[model samples]
Structure formats: structure tokens, C-alpha cells
Target: MMRRLLWFSLLVGLLLVVMPAAAQTTSTTAQVPEAVEITVGDEVEGALTEAAPSAEYALQGAGGMLINISLISEDFDSYLSVRDDAGTIVAFNDDSNGERNSRIVGLAVPEGAVYTIVAESYGQYIGSAAQTGDYTLSVSEAQVLRIEYTQTVEGELTSDAFSLDYIFTGSSGDTVVINEGSDDFDSYLRLLDASGAELFSNDDSGGSLDSQIGPFVLPSTGSYTIRAGSLSGEATGNFTLSLNRIESQAIAYGDSVEVEFTNNAREHYFTFTGAYGDIVTITADSSRTVDTDLTLNDPYNSQVMFDEDGGSGFDPEIDSASLFADGTFTVILRAVDSANGTVVVTLDRVPPQSLDEGSQIAGFSSSRTQIPMLFTGVAGEKVRLTLTSPSGNTSSSLNLDVRQDGTSIAYANANTLSAITVEFTVPNDGDVNLLISEYSYTNFQFEVTLERVG
Candidate 1:
């Protein structure tokens, strides 16, 4: 009878094990939905148990609209699977350490797609120790942001001028306005396109003291950058920029010279002069193809001067042209395009007559009435005189007195050296006096050259 009772007790225990409450419910019905909550700076959780096969969930639409997914579970030894409604496994997380309790899984979902998260025991476990845990799921819409910018110049924008306000806009229909404040600095504002291409930029206007404010239009509906900074010849300042939409043409002068395009082609002329040793910088800009040429021309319409070829295309640069005589000259830039566009050109002249190889002098005396010197100059022309000594040293004084046929043509002192350049036309043949005198005993050196500026 006791043995019978023992056998009955064992049978009852087996029945209880087979009908465990947690294991029975696992296969009885579909998995129930769970809730997940999150706060800023907190790691997202709740995916581990929700992704189990026993807790089946379905996602809707294309996957791209689904931005992100996350899960958390204390069952570190368990495995989790994430799938779409079509049973496509999108993500999985597994841990073999049974002692560890925390686990997480995440995936970026495709837009307009359905997804499911499933958790299950790794191996064949008929009823793995009555699996039980609380799980939560959460979904939120993704955010997209974009910006567009445009700039325009309304009136003359010059070196010392005021510009009008600028405007700006955002993807969510937000707006801003920028104004030029008094800061005494030259500033530049530009617009960029979606592909990181510069569409427009503006500075001071040609021959003007102030720059005008204008509107800039973005080429497409996407992201963009608007930049502002100080340009050359001005101090830094606080300026305002705005975002708005308006219809206007972006007309920018290329450099110093103002160029206009009527039929997509035009030409302009300019002139410059300097000492024999100075260098000049020339710059040109055009929306269409352009060509520049610098030539030395005679007064009789004959091309007697140098004609350095100014190459084709926009913004051609050339440097260092020497003057051989004292006369009028011309530099020309030609811009052309099948499409209508404008060109702007500028020339920065540095007088080359300041010094060359011939202006050095050697002497040993504190007081000298007349000092003889030799200089190579243009035939029949007088040479300008310049003298230099140690700054703040009056003892090392010197004077360069220039003469032609015993008549004083030019004189220069060490203190006033830079402003003493003289222009004298050569008579086609003769010797000119290049004299030097010492006011006190001090070593001195200088450079001299002849310049022809016709």
C-alpha cells in the first residue's frame, strides 16, 4: 500500500511538470503586445523578449520608413530574432553566458515596412525551464531637416559702403534676416547648393565705397550652407544674414574693371604706370569664356610695345611687367560666350622704377662737395634719384643729385627716399649726370633703374 502511494505521488508530480502554467501558455495563443518607455539620455530597451518566437509581432509597410529598433532582456543566455511580416530575419542577438542577465538588440528599419521581434532558447528545449519575463516595445517617427539660402545685390556695393539686409529659410518654414552693422570690416556672403557647390558670392562693387545687399536662390529643395567672412582691405565686423525667397539676377563685378555682356561677348581697355623695378598684378573674371591681352602700342596706332598673350577662360592672372619708357599704354581683356554672361577685370600696378642693378654707390667721407657716380638709363632721358640709410641715423646722410647737360634735373635725400622718383623723357641720345654726395660719415646703399612708361 505504501509503495502504491509512492507511485501515485510520482505520477502526480509528472502531470504537474507537463502542465506547467508558463509552458502551457507559451504555445496556447499568439504573443501579446508590450509597451516600452524611454527618456532622453537613456538607452532604449524591451526588444529581447518581444523578439522571441513565442511572442510573435508583425510590422507593416516598406522597411525604409522604419528608422530604428532596440531590445533589452535579463536572459543573457537566450537568443532573439527580429523579422518582418514576411518572415525575413532582419536582426538577431545571442549570448551563451547563463550567469549574465543583460542583453540588447537593435536594427534600422526600412521605410514603410513591417517588422517582428522574437526571443527563443538557442537549443532544442521542449519547455526551457518555463521561460518568463516582462518585455516592452516602442516605435517613434524619424525626423528630417533641410535648409536653403539665397543672396542678392540691389545697388552699388563699394569699398566703403553699407549693404542691405540678407534673408534665410529652413525646411519647416522658418525664416531669418541679417543686416550689416557698423564694424569697419569688409565682409563676403555666399550661397551653396545641395551638392556642396558654390552658387553665388558678393563683395564691394566696382569703384564704389559700399556693397549692396541682395537675395540668393537655392537651386534645389535640399540642404545648403550660407557663409560670411571679412574680405581683403577691411576689418572684421558683425553682420546679419537672412533667409527669404525673391526673384533677382546675381550680377557680380569680376574685379576692378566693369564688364557688360550684351550678346555674350565684349572687350575693355585699361592703363597703368610705375617705376622700373615695381611689379603689377592683373586679374579678370567672367561667367562666359574670356581672353586677355597686354600690349605696348605706339601713338600712331602701331603695335610697337610688348604683347604678352593673355590666355583664354575666366579669371586669368598675370604678374610682373617692366616699363621701358615713359608713355601711355593699354591693356585689353575680351570675354565671350554663346550663353549670355558678364566679365570683370582688375589691374594692380606697382611702380618698377624704384631700383634695379645700377643704383649702388661706395664712398668714405663725412663731408663731400661733389661725388661722381655712373648709372645706365634710357637714351636721352634723366634718371630719378633715391637714397637710403639706417633709420634714425642722421650721421649717414646722402643726396642723389641728377643732372643732364650740367642742369640739375632731380635731387633726393635719404630721409625722403620713396617720394623722390622723377620722370624725364629721353632725347634719343646723350650722357646724364648721376651724382652722389655725403652729408656725414655713414655707410649707405641704394638701387636705380630707368623706366619707360608710355
Candidate 2:
């Protein structure tokens, strides 16, 4: 009798292979789910048991619907599978979601085809081990969220209280902003790293019910998550989410680039790659009421230079001829005093012009009375520079003021002679600026010569 019972059990298991999957929900007693219609955004509660190892449901339509089947079971490791009406297995899942539960997301189904969703104990799929539990099945439209630079997304918060998601790909030390200023509802924002761990969250940070979280630096170059939500589950209204990437514009030598600030308290960054001891000047111009405030950051994001009122009438300027480092340099442009406007920025690398042991360069300050020039000399080298005019004697005396990085180094005034000469030992390997100003009313041509002797 014992041998006969074991043979019958094995025969019954073999017979299950030939039966419809919906009818094979139980090991011994066959059970099938009644055909039920379901749609996206629908969450249903159901249970499974040892007596009925699987539950089958019908999705009335054909394929092309992105279906997400989630099975939550506390009593057993859950498993999920989908099959066509003809009992052909289409998809399966064991632990794609989390823990021992199962979830199948973003599965595209066929058109005009009926699919059977089956939930079962993971053990039952392998052998005769019986498992039972209650589970919740969530069916919703799975959307692929992607965020790009300067993108604006508009959405609504309805009674369902859905959380909108977006994926942001960024680099380390990059600052980004998530703004919901146009949201009518009490908005909330949350930032998550690639692993879905919360990095930051903000509510009512924009001075109103809307949300704004930013100047947030990314930890690495990868995908990050931004969740747009409401202050509470009950609050619902329309909202707009905007993503802005704050990265420096790489300004090469003699390159001119333009950037704008759409609003106040926003920072625009421009980067330039230069060598150590290089001199650079940045000029910001705007036609609007926008007064620019400029800040220079080294490769390590450290503040090395700042200017708020050094330009032509409220514009920002940076005219440093001696840079300390030789890497990426960041130039930050901000609107002054909470003003918003467009600003055109240009960067010029102004290194010291190299002169030979005895070289001469001629220039004229004819149309203007003042001229500025730059030159370089080596340390310990006795350098002699002579500034002369066309006439042997002029009514106006020419004044010469030479400076190294804004510090006065030499000065000369021609009272009655045709030329002014200044000879001094080179202080360092830096550039010197010559400010030639006329003290009298005379338009004159000038020649500057430098001779090195030591």
C-alpha cells in the first residue's frame, strides 16, 4: 500500500505539467481564478495558501501596457509569473523588488492577448514544500523617469497622492537645483542618491508653500533620484519641477563666453584652464539693471578671488596677472543685490610678454593721453627701460609709473628732457604694468626699450 501511494503522488505531479497553469494552483486539488478585469493604477489585496499555492488574475486587454506586479508576503518567500491564455509562460520573478517579496516592473505585454498573473510561494515552484500567506498586489503604470539639463516638468498632485520621480545624471562637486516655485500646492522635494537613499529633503524652503532645494552638490557622477511630492498626502494641486545644472564653462585662452542669470541669488560658473603664474582678466557686461558680482575659485573649489564693484560702473572685473595654481579655474557670476539680468562675460589670459636682452617695442598714445603696457624680466637681472617721445622736447612731461601685480615698483617723471629712463634690479619673474600718463597738453608717439644687464 505504501509503494502504491508514492507512485500515485509522483503520477499526480507529472499530470500537473499537462494541465493549464491556472488549474495547477494546488498540488493535489486543482484551482483556477475567475477571469477578472484590471487596469493600471489599481492596487488589489489578496491572499495565497498551502491549499491554493497560486492565485491567477486576468488582465482584459492585449499587450503594450507597462504592468508592475508586486507581491508582498510575510509568511513565505513570494514568487510571481505571467502566462498567456494558451498557458505559455511569458515572464517570471522571484526577488526583483526587495527582501523575499517579488515585483515585476516595466513589463510590456502583447496586444489583443490575455495575460494571467500568478502569485505563489517560491518553494512551491521548486518542490512539494507548502507555503501560504496574504499579499498585496499593486498594479500601476511604470514610467521611466529621466531629467536633463534645463528641463521643466509639470505635473499634478491628485487624490491618489502620487510621487513623481526623475533621474539626474551629474558629476561630483556639481551643484544642481530642484525648484517648484510655480507649484500651487504645498510642495515638497527630496533628493536620493543612486541607491535610493535619501540625501536631502526640503519643504517650504522657497519662502512659500512651494519647494526649492539646491545648490546641492552631487557626491559622484551617476544617476540620482528627485522625488516631487506634497507636504501631506491630503494636499493636492498642480506643480512644476525644474532641473538646472550649474557647471562652469571652460574658457580657453583668449576665449569669450556669455552666460545669464534668469533670477536673483543664482550663480553662473565659468571655468578656465591656465598655468601657474598666468595672468587673467574677466570682464562682465550687461545692458540690464543687472550688476554682476564675480568670484574666482581654484581647482579645489576654494575662493581665491572676488570682486563686486571693480568693473566699469557696477560690472564685475578680475585683472590678476599672477595666478597661484595651474589647473581648472572657476569663475562665478552672480547678480548683485538680488538683481536678475543677462550678463556677457569674457576671459583673457594676460601673461607677461617676454623681452630679449635688448628689445624694443613702439606704441603711440596719440588719440589718448594715457597708455598701458606689460613686460617681463628675470630675477637679479639689471633691467633698464627708457620711455621717449617723438620731439626732443615737449610742452607736456610724460609720467611713468610701473607696477608689479598692482604694487608700485618704479616711477619717473620727465620735467624737461625728451625721455624718461628707469633702471632697477628685477624683483621676480612677474609681469610689470606701465602706466604712461601725459602731464601736459601734447599728443605724442612713444617708444619703450628694455635692456637686461647683470
Candidate 3:
């Protein structure tokens, strides 16, 4: 009986040893730890050297759990993927280019359920035996306000006499007061006039925070536009604008005018001296157009002269007339309607010189040659010179010299290849003569006219 009991005891001990070995094999095949107890600030680390088909873990908390995941080692390519109990992957970062230190952050893991974190390596086997580097996963809550907003102004606010138009809209207000939260982005606003001019603008300077607000005023309240964009040219946000009623005024021409234009079109006014052979200087404000043909006529005689266009329609001053005849003369200046508006004209008189009938001169050449031709004339008198070339050949150069007896008063050169116009004034209203010459071997056609100015 004693021998049988001894044998039975030995068999029971052997069963205990074999049962523990079977349990160890089962645990190894499962691959997951029985109970992973992780605290709020603790980090879990593991290594992976190859692609993982599946992985998992579980949290114990009830609410507001956050996770920051990262690759902890730089030796092998590390990629992280997270999945819920049903095997749906919720977060992942892969080292697509085989980078050794690939990482991503703030992946949320659900509480009370198994959250699987799978690490993968591009070219190496990943598991407990073949893994080469460690990956870290952490948990926490995320902060509010992912990105702040801002504003900025672009383009000029003023040009010429009119103020530029500006516009401001979106969440960005006109008077933004910047604060700690106003650092991430920018906003834009502008106010434009009827002429498409920008008058005012606002950006980040008026905001309390980076995000936009309201209470922006328009330069003048007819119809204004607004736009908003990022200061760094990236990121997404919004802006807005508020408008109030305001009074405005505009200027217009009055009724006390010699030549009145009833149609809202631009016009020019010209006046001629009726008694004295006086010089008249006509000045128009830059707001008015200048440069055109000024024509003067008496009962039997009339004359026309060219005036130059003015720059910067702000302060336009043109010497429009120089009268040498004593008869009653009527004047009119003509211009193309380049703009829409009323133009104002002002006229004043200066001293004039005595008139004289200039002597007519003519020149002819059989072949293309330079010859010294001379003629005489009076100062402040209209002088006309004409040259006719044979029809076929037009390439030639003509030079003219005007002199008082032997003293040269003026010289001019012209081309027969193209029609030329030359006008000059005589220094003295006395006997003036002219000399003509050529420089090229071709027939020429030319005409010259001169009107004196006082």
C-alpha cells in the first residue's frame, strides 16, 4: 500500500510541471500581455523590425483621454498604426520613404476598449525577436484653438488727387486690438470709390486676437467691397464688416460761363482780344483736358495754331493765344472728349508785338543737291516756304536758314521721305532772309509755315 501511494504522489507532481509548460505555450501564441496597467502620464514602448498584421491595447479611464504617439528610436524604419477592437484603423503614420525616425502625434485611443498600436518597418521583419528600434505612445488632452487668425493691408491708399478706395470684411474689424491669441494669421479689408480708387484699409492692427471681428466703417457709404485672406498666405479663417450712414458732398461747375456745356461732357473755352493786339495766356486746371487746336477768326481773316497736352491734369497752364492783328477776333479751342466731366477755363492778356506781312520764298532744284538759298522777312510775321520735288524719288533732306540781311535768325532741317511741319518766331519784326540746302541725293517735297507769338 505504501509503494502505491509513493507512485501516485510522484505522478501528481509530474502533472503539475507539464500543465505549467502547456499554459506557457498558450500565452506565447496569444502574443498580448495579460493586463497592461498604464497610468495617466506613463509611456508605452516597443520595437518593430517588420510589417505588423495586427496589434492591440486597452485603456481604463472614462473621458477626455489623449494620446501622443512617436517613434522612439532612429535605427530602423518605424511606422505606427492604431486600431479599435473591431480592427478598424483610426490613426497611422508610415515611413513611406524608409525613414528611420518616422513619427506622428495626438492620436485618440478610446477608453474601456482595446486600442491596438501596430508598428511596421519597410524592409525588416517586425516582432519580439527581430525588432531593432522602439516606438513610444502617450496619452493626454488636446488644446483649444488649433490656429489663430490675422490681417494685413496691401496696395496704395492714395493716388493723384482722389483718395484710394478701401474695403474690409470677414471677421476682421477696422479697429482690431491685438492680444495673446492674435499671433497666428492675418486679415485684409479695403474701401474703394466710384473711380476704383482704394481709400482706406485695415489688417491685424485692429484685432484684439488673431481672429477677425466686426465694426468696420466704409470710406463713403455708396457701394463698397471687402476681402479677407491669410497673412502667411496659408491657413483658413473668416472676417466681417459693419457700415454706418454718413454725409458727403461733391463739386460742380456754376452758370456764369461764356461757353456752357449742358451735356455732362468735357469742353474747352477760348476768348480772343477784340481791340488791342494783345497776347492771351489761357490756363485750365489739371482736372480739365489741355492741348488741341485754337482757332481765331475776324470778319474776313482767320488763323489756327496747335497747343500741347498738359501732364498731371492738376495744374494745367497753356499759352493759347498771341494776337498781332487789331480787328475784332473770335476764338475757339477744340479737343477730343477724352473724359467725362466739366472743364474750367481762365484767360489773361499780355503785351503784343507789331504785325508785319512776311515775304514769301520759293526754292527748286533739278537734281538732289545742296544750294545756298536766301530770303528776307519781318519779326512777328507769318512766313511760308514751300519746296516741290520730282514725283518718283522721295528720299531727300532739306535744310533752311533764316537771316536778317546777313545775320542768321533761325535754322531748320526736314526730310522729303515724309511730310514735315516746322514753325518758328522771328526775334525782330524786321527784314529777314532765308537760305536753303540739301544733304542727300533724292527728290524732296516740303512746306514750312511760321506764326509769330507775342
Q: Mind giving the per-residue lDDT tens digits that candidate 3 earns over 196-241?
A: 3344444443323332222223344243333233343233333333
Question: Whose TM-score is greatest here?
Answer: 2
Per-residue CA lDDT of model 1 for 1-454, tens digit only, reads 9999999999999889888765756444335455222321233334324334344445443243312233334543455566665877766644311232213211345445556655444441244443445443333322222233444322222322222212234443222222232245666555544332355555542112222223222344555444443454224444544344432222221337566655523444454443322234555555444444443222222222222243244455454343323444345444433444455656565432323455453333422233444344466544345443324334335566665555566666665342235666544344455555554544433434455464
**On a 0 to 1 TM-score scale, where does candidate 2 land against the true structure?**
0.33
Mark the regions of model 3 whose C-alpha exceeds 4 Å error after superposition.
1-40, 47-56, 60-62, 96-99, 109-114, 123-137, 143-454
Decoy 3 TM-score against native? 0.25
- Better candidate by TM-score, 2 or 3: 2
**lDDT of candidate 2?**
0.69
Residue 364 in candidate 1, Cα distance off native in Å? 38
TM-score of 1: 0.21
Model 3: per-residue Cα lDDT at residue 228: 33
RMSD of each: 24.3, 21.2, 28.3
Worst 10 residues of 3 by lDDT: 156-165
Question: Model 2, range 241-289, lDDT digits (tens) per residue?
Answer: 8998765566777777766567533677676787655667788887646
lDDT of 2 at 79: 86
- Superposed Cα RMSD, model 1: 24.3
